[model samples]
Target: MSELNVELSETERSFGLRQIPAGHARMLVIGRCLPQPIGEVWNALTDPARIGAYFAEPQGDFRRGGDYELPGFSRGTILRCDPPRLLTVSWMPAHGNGGELEIHLADENGATRVELLYASVRKRFAVMDPEVNEWAAGPGWEFFLDNLSAHLDGREVRPTDRDWQSMEGTDRELYEARNTEWVRVREEFEREHSPLPSPE
Candidate 1:
């Protein structure tokens, strides 16, 4: 058991973090507050044109059961689309691995809260080194969410030069150790930012 951590931006109303369950699995959620109305944020996430401006080479269709391919990112079928509220999809990665991403939006105070839940990531590499596997998901989600937040707020979020630059040279044994540490802190962060009370 580890204490989840929170990393808040003093300069912006955005934050990101990770959560892991020992040797079982990991879940990552990253998002930000949009100064614009909920409808605008909804469009930015659901609109093909708006999504292309932030992530992927070009935006694909947004209808449920339709193809949602973004050049480099995994291509998959849209599982659900409840317009302005829920957008769920299954993403297929290059290695034949895939996962589901659920985007939820709600009106909070005056700003729209966008929550992205990237779950059930393939545990394909977890056996190799659960730690290293844990390493990839969080940062990857962070990168994507940061871009989404920036785009929604009319800011540009540049991709990092190297993805794993932060985890370069740590010993093999400590990889998972540090991963758990990050997971603990990240979970804490989510609890704090949660718009509603967490379900029991």
Candidate 2:
């Protein structure tokens, strides 16, 4: 399979603060269009076999209220599952910074549009440390979308961990350039939407 270019120009990213039961959390919204039908895109996201092909090997029950784990990535419960439309899950990583993740799918023209929303509580003193900001989540999701695109295009999809380690020459440079663009986008988001006060 041939490699696909990392294209952020086709993606729409937004950031905001949302009030959840726990408190105020940072929310990252990423929207992108896939060159496939909505049903195909939805299946790739929900089917264990298909997901494993592009994303991670998901284990455990897949229904609402069921628990699931993405091996080394994250483990969470399925909060909601609406076929070919919306999927919401609780996201709990090993770092213990838990959050909620929502995947919304829609038909755009003849293709499918995917919107991924992740909201995690802001860590205390997060402002003191620039590295802890929510913007850090941007690149990971972008990488996933890129992988998804490749899978839909019938190309081999490299696992995130292996992809980074194996990337070289132009591929590695492209990935780094994408990361830099994400940083700029995050800065612009912060300037336009001031963060909400940290919940007491």
Candidate 3:
């Protein structure tokens, strides 16, 4: 129960539509700087043991073109792996639609700035609201990064579900505030960009 304080301002979020092989995909970009060296942050992200400690229990081959699964979460193939820098994968979640996930890491003044890009295609016949989608996905990534930050700071990390349930007091209040912030950001993004054309 390390203090669950997440600064929404620390994260840069954007929403747009991109063309993929399947069709038009809604792209969500979230970037935040972690106060740790680049190499240390990279290892925490790629190493199975380190990832399991902070994120989820990872299982499967972890090389380029290899398949991997984060039990009860998402499973997909490792599309590209460039150590200490970039890692791209085809992300197929246990629920909802699948997408492409890319992690970009860079050295920013001796600290690591990690950017996560997730793009999921709009279902052909299913109607979806881009604003709803952005807000829903944004907070989840923020939560994961919060855990990563705690882990980097040498704080105890807990399973996502249990950790979420255990949130109380200030932590719970901050979590709720984060969600509200996401809604505000999404609303602003929607006003700036026209909604995607309805699926045929």
Candidate 4:
């Protein structure tokens, strides 16, 4: 199978997406900016301690061909890892049933531009859809980035461990609705701010 490729430029001030052919379909390319240097941002992403501080359990060697294991979200081998620049990993669950996540970093005026290239997502993993990941990568990562910046600036950002394994009918419905709205808003946002250029 030919690997998918997503190229994103002008990311510090905008976001971009590209659909590439691989096996059966196209994968989404999501990205954003960070308010810290490349090394700081890279460490925040690759360092298990720092990642756990913001999100859930994070364990990975963060190198080419090394596997990263998180309890639920994803678990797979790293395909590429360039310190303070790029980290591409294959995300799988149940041993071997998933695809890849490619993260790119660029330096812009002392801050780091972080771009997430989520590729080769399988159809079976469609239930926990892109909307859910948006909740995590979009708003969730924004939340984490804010905390990371604060911590880097010598401020305090307390970590939390809250489990909500159970929710009533209305609660679950509301959660799903909100996440749907998030996806919509994110699409609108990208269109407005970084409208895809017309093909020549």
| Best model per lDDT | 2
Query: What tens-digit string does per-residue lDDT give for candidate 4 at 13-88?
Result: 2223434223332234445666778888888778887667666566776667777787655687878788879887
lDDT of candidate model 1 versus the reference: 0.57
Going through the candidates in the order shown, the clash numbers are: 6, 0, 0, 0
lDDT values for all models: 0.57, 0.74, 0.73, 0.53
Q: Is candidate 1 or candidate 2 better by TM-score?
A: 2
TM-score of each: 0.63, 0.82, 0.81, 0.57
TM-score of candidate 1 to 2 decimals: 0.63
Sorted on lDDT, highest at the top, how do the candidates line up?
2, 3, 1, 4
Query: Model 2 misses residue 165 by how many Å?
Result: 7.5
lDDT of 2 by residue, 1-200 (tens): 22334364778877767665456787778899888999999988998988888877899998999999998778999999988899999887767777788999999887999999988784531121244422246666777887988998998875566534356776566556566665666578678877555545
Question: What lDDT is reached at residue 198 by model 4?
Answer: 29
Error of 4 at 32 (Å): 1.8
lDDT of 3 at 23: 60
lDDT of 3 at 45: 88
lDDT of 3 by residue, 100-196 (tens): 8788999999999999887777443121233433224556677788888889999986457543335677655665666666666656766887676
Model 4: how large is the Cα RMSD against the reference? 10.1
**Candidate 2: lDDT of 54?**
81
lDDT of 1 at 90: 74
Candidate 4's C-alpha runs over 4 A off are: 1-25, 94-97, 124-200
